[model samples]
Target: MSSCNSAPKRVGNKVKCNLSFFDTIRKRPIGPSGYQIGYDDLVALKLYSNFYHYEIDKLEHDSHYGGIFNLEFSLDGKLLVAACEGKQVLLFDAANQKQINSVDSAHQNCVNCVRFLNDKHFATCSDDTSIKIWDIRKLKSCLRTLHGHSNWVKNIEWSEKDNVMVTSAFDGSIYAWNLKSHSENNMLYDKVFLMNGLMRMKLTEDGSKMVIATTNGYMIIIHDLNLATLATDLRSFKPSLYRLMQISDQCYPVATIYNYLFSPTRKRNRIEFIDDFPNEAEVISSLQIHPHGWSVVSRNINGEENEEWTSVHDIQSRDPSDYENSFMYIEEDIPDEPEPEEPPNQRPTDLWLGYISLDEYSNHNRDPSQVSQNIWENNFQLPAMGILNSGLIGVNASYNAYFQQHPEQRNKVITNLPRMTHFIKEKNVGKGYIKELCFSSDGRIICSPFNRGVRLLAFNNQCQELSMCVPDNPQQLKTIVEMNDYHKDIVVSCKFSPTHYQLVSGCLGSEIKWYQPVV
Candidate 1:
């Protein structure tokens, strides 16, 4: 009965509607609070919040035959030398990165250290417990082998003054040699200065003293030949007079003595004084090393310039009781003060403050103008502190962490170092540790070698890194290139060419890699 009224079923007042597919997919209109995002919109967001860009470039070059160990440049920046575990020293033309010469069989074992004394001569020490001096001009062994140490020679330093050389060994001994008369027969000039223990040695700039780092964590000072000798003769033919003789001929073995300068260290550090003949030794000063284990280089001031020569007076012999009432205050004659002149347009920028002193001015009878001038000149004495401050500021600006925190300050400091134009990381070369690093005199480029490759990094800061991974339709995009492959290996050492754009690196595998910078 209901089938007959199917048409009448819709008369119940309930209706159903269907929307088209196009209407469902249609985009909504822009609103004042909504954003319209394109590809650039996403990129802008990324750059503002997360993305970074670094550009880098790689150059292909000749590969090293073996792993690199150490690299260095000559003092004058003309030669780039590499010490390879292959028992050879390779010299390269710095300008072109071409192999100039090779010293085959330069060492019996791995060359651990190499240094050039001058443009013509250099020295190399090896694990074979020997050191060889070579003549760059002859490209042959210099016929002088420093062969005093019984164990591995760890380090060597040539004196800036004479032909004197100092070498330290793992055998806990140090030998000072005179290379001026260097021959096989005269291997060592002095009895190994027997540091009494194993130690590392560093000589001063003037070669007047040496600082010795002992295995016992003690730093000892060895005064140069400037000290006087103290001697007491115990044996005499007749003890007749029982004389208490003062031998003026016997010197005191030391000039002016002062307390040891204490510095922070990262280990248990102590300065010990030792006397060999008398078997006297004492710890003069002790200091704890800082947590960072960073070594500090300090310049010592000994009043060399302001020292006034005074006559020796027997003040101790004078009885204070005799002159207690009438003690006279003696004054030295003061020098005349010069007229003050106008400051130069460009004053010495790097002045050092040495010492400051204040003394009382006395005038028995003098011209008012002269006295005023003297007062003005002597009123305040400031040591070369200004020079020291300027030097320190320059150093801090270039290398200090504080400067790195403030970009503006860093830029200002960098402006002062007009020589440092750019810095770049070399890509693709050796596989070893960079033990030593040196730049050419001109500082146009840099060289480092590690493991199997010798890398030449550009000095210009124009290189950029390319991004290889960017998401499609992402909110932001960025690119980054890492040049870590160039230094993948343990690069114990690397050096730049002295005269050219060449770099050399040495590896533990006894091979040397020479690289030329591609312009």
Candidate 2:
């Protein structure tokens, strides 16, 4: 069938047209090792902080009763699954924003997290202390029911590398279920690691490293995802979150109660449960590791004033020094140089008395290398990080900004977690704490829940305000897009589409709003 200008003509096993399209005849076989994500085809999201939501009166509950807790996009970006507090698994066709199917009573208790095993199969964990696997085609019954956790299972991560599904629960336990064999095998399924006060766990897209947000006020990172090593050390693990904080005293989960009086160096800035500290449990209940696995977007909840802040925490990277000097410059285009003349300028061998005049040396020669020696992370014990939005200056601003007029574009910064919250004048969402946030596929944007809306933030896109990884101030986001007035209640969950420019969010009012740009 054909028209002269726009028609398909078949001749000798070939199709021809004025404009033609063809896929590769020899398509490479996609294997267990996944390919990289191409962000070129993605769309733009423009709802910034000043953006207003157009309210529409409506009363429709996607979940039977409670609010939606967490959601996920499938690998193909065609399906989305929502874990609701009502114990329902709501599925939708993402492209059309149509409800495809629903798993009523998906869990015995509140479903906490949903993860995709593939396009048609997915996994979900819940407060019922179990994890279940289901095939989208047949939702009447789950394919498998995994039972292990003693308490509420809140996080579920499937490791493509290990072919195991890992789950974390309120009982401070993490177990892995092997999927390769399709049968429970002792070696593949078991407790890989354990820790107290764990609220959630996340893995990078590669399944290389895992980040855990805990109630103990620590952002725990396990290197190389060496769970076997973690399983071994589980015996020596002490809940001495305090002693560890005193020891790694200079590590992740660093926070500042307030910047005016409390020095950034004070250990009290570290989040953790302390009977002495007020509020309640110092909990970091929600977090997501960047797809690149170099950074984490988390809500650092501090007991002080019960503040919550959205922060970007740079974790350990391939090059240890990449994170060591949060204030140093890192040029993405520059080839890895030999760190340049690090060996203290060869003590000019011609000195006769073997003693050079102190005045003869440059400040660089006289003083220790500011970055190499890293006085901040080493001596003073301060977090070298950046914040996105915060009520407090110290939390919202990067310390480097205090010194450098414009800090170099380093990749990491650690600011006061709770201090970086966006201050809303009205009855805001979570005081200063962010309920939940998700990162875009490229690790460049974050859609976090604000008071009654969602904040779409782009980071380090070379914009002066947020170009520096450790921006002097909290406006480290490349741009801010806010969407409000549409939902009647506070937004609870927000996530970016992996392949498209669309955004989806859920609110405490039991609604799921699909946001796509209108041409």
* TM-score of every model versus the real structure: 0.40, 0.61
Q: Report the C-alpha lDDT of model 1 over 1-519, residue by residue, as the tens digit.
A: 011111111111211122232432343243423333332223222221211112122112224324444566777776777766556677765544557788778876656567787777888876566888888888666557777665446567677665676776544455667777655475645533442234345554455555554323224444432211100111111111100011121111010011111111211121223211111112111111111111111111112221111000000112324323321122222234344353543332332322221111111222322211111122222223223222221233333454355423222200000111122222222211223433333322223332233332321121111111211321111111111223334454555445544444444444343443211
lDDT of each: 0.36, 0.54
Largest TM-score belongs to which candidate?
2
Backbone clashes, each candidate: 59, 24
| Off by more than 4 A, model 2 | 1-63, 181-188, 239-281, 318-434, 460-479
- Taking the tens digit of each residue's C-alpha lDDT, what string does model 2 give over 161-215? 7777888875567787776654442224677666545677888778766777776
Q: What is the lDDT of residue 143 in candidate 1?
A: 53
Best by lDDT: 2
Prediction RMSDs, each to the true structure: 30.0, 20.1
